[model samples]
Target: MNNNSTGGLPVAETCNERITSPTSNLGPQFTLVVLVLLAILMVLLALITVFGNGLVILAFLVNKNLRHRSNYFFLNLAISDFLVGAFCIPLYIPYILTGKWIFGRLLCKLWLVVDYLMCTASAFNIVLISYDRFVSVTKAVTYRIQQGITSNTIARMVSVWVFAFLLYAPAIIIWEHVAGCSIVPDGECYVEFYYTWYFLLCASVFEFFIPCISVAYFNMHIYWDIKKRKRNRLRSTVSISKRVSVPSKGNGQPSRVSFLLKKEIPSLDLETEDGLSTSSRTQTPPQVMDCSHLSTTSGNDRSAALKVKTRSKLHKDKQIAKSLAIIVSVFAICWAPYSLLMILRAACHGECVYEFLYEITFWLLWLNSSVNPFLYPLCHVRFRKAFMKILCPKRLAVLPPSSQSSLREPN
Candidate 1:
């Protein structure tokens, strides 16, 4: 019996070593606590982003007033945020908490694919919004008449999904599993630094660099055009004023002015006097020289000027879309560090400088997921008004009380 027990001791020790080796001495208690706190933060951010973006989408769908080309793009963006929160955040929470992946190879591949695709789609959606804004503001009259939520917008959205799928395909095909200790014992999954790097590079180029450059270019052109238009308007006004103030040739009168101000000058009205009653031909005051008529003309001029100004404002809105593009660019910047770290880690074939940087980058990337909804409200008056209508029904009374209450309810 003693000899049998001695042999069993070696077998038990081997089992223990295999089970504990992966996570042995991984971190101190305080470090674990910090990680837990981070996990909580990620959860809260995900919730807020998901809910806020969902609200934006809901407002668009329910508000007939928001049924337009611009809102269509916003709908796509909101969908992307919803997918990230619903699918990616849940998978990631567990992974981050344990500092390892216990999900199966199939799940890992699937999650990675979805993550990349949704993120790519989201980035491209921003580009589309920027372009749409550019079109609307640059050509307000045409845009107001023609652009709306329609089959064309749906086709564009479909194309965005197709592009995202193509963008994310490589990650699933190329990634290989690495042996590591995960949250679950007896679980095996893959992790590699090269895959991370590849994701970062591709995402940065399409999502960050391209969008940023395009938005900036569009905004600069739009602003320049607006400035030129303002100058032209000023020149036109000066010309009109000069024409109005100039006195014409005289025969006891300014000849050129006589023809221009004929309706106002009493002597000029002599031709029509014989056709009218004596009371209708009463003498006019010099101080009131066609001022009523002039004011009416000026009012028309001002109305035309207002129309031009509204068109210019529409152009400025296109620049706002450019601003959204910049916001997407900022998201790429936030994500870049982690991606670079992952690539470096992979290149080294082990953890090195990337270890600390990776954690920081991870948090930053997570932050990007939470900020865009707030940005939309900040940059867009329409979105802000819509959001307000949805949030505070008393302010926008277009909707009935029941419908407004429903809108305010949590989803």
Candidate 2:
């Protein structure tokens, strides 16, 4: 019995060494608490990611109002995030907790493939959404009419997935074979190319740099275009008011221009009359231009109504673009650290960068997936209503038509 007990001491000491090695930087109690907290946080994040994205998918399917061309990109994003929650994050939890790839080589390969494909798809979907918003806003007249046509939108969404797959799947699938030996060790699972500086730089460029640049450009233009449109609207309102306002021969009050009644200005909105009073307040007694005839003119009412409808459609498009901009901004924040660290990891082969920083950045990337569901509802009223109705149908009160903002594109 003594001999046996003495013999087991070495085995016990080896086990202790193995366990302590990974946590040498922190106290044993502190490490335990950190690991436990991480495990809990990760579990919560995974559940939220799945639930939130699932809600988005359900809302999109049920709410016909959300089936517009721009929103299809959102649906694509939700699907990718849903897959991340369902497969990628959950699969990674054990690896994170144990600090080993205990799930075996086959599962590791499968996890890596799905993880890269879905995440890259998610990034590409964001870029697509940004580009779509740009086109819709800058070319509102043409793209507005094409919103109902599904073919082009479908093709774009499909291409995002296909491109994402081509970018990462082929390399992940064949890297071991190409290298003629497995670079990943027996108990570890990571992309073998992380050690290759050139590939990392190229991947970072395609995945992070280009997308960031494109989003920034699109968003900047969208902002400028929106501002320009508003400025033009104000100027048109001012010019039309000036042209129509003439001094009455008797009371000195402004009288309507005869030509305005003789011909229809299709761009003229009834709202222009409201602006006339506001603009006149600074210079003279508030003179309300008589726009009653403008609404009653032959075919002018139809034209003005059409103009109002188009303007409203553009307004809704602006709102949607703003929401997507928030999404893109969030993505940049979450991804920037990880992307920079990846380049560092590649340049130094993990010598300069701390492992904890890499792990934090990894979690931050996943955090974006968790955050998007909340963001959609917060930024977009339509999505909020849909989510409320779905989650608490009985509790949801019917909204008046005036209160309900329809996100549908104009027919």
Candidate 2: give the clashing pairs: none
> What would the per-residue lDDT of candidate 1 be over residues 376-396, giving only the tens digit for each residue?
644666666677877886776
Worst 10 residues of 2 by lDDT: 1-10
Clashes of each: 5, 0
- Per-residue error (Å), model 2, residue 339: 0.7
Would you list the C-alpha lDDT of every candidate in the order shown?
Answer: 0.57, 0.69
Give Cα distance to truth, residue 259, candidate 2, Å: 2.8
Report residue 307 deviation for candidate 1 (angstroms).
7.8
For model 1, the run of ten residues with the poorest summed lDDT:
269-278
Query: What is the C-alpha lDDT profile of model 2 across 280-365, one tens digit per residue?
Result: 22222225534434322433444444346446654765785677678668989999999999787657656678877887898898
Q: What are the runs in model 2 whose C-alpha is more than 4 Å off?
A: 1-30, 247-257, 260-264, 267-321, 397-411
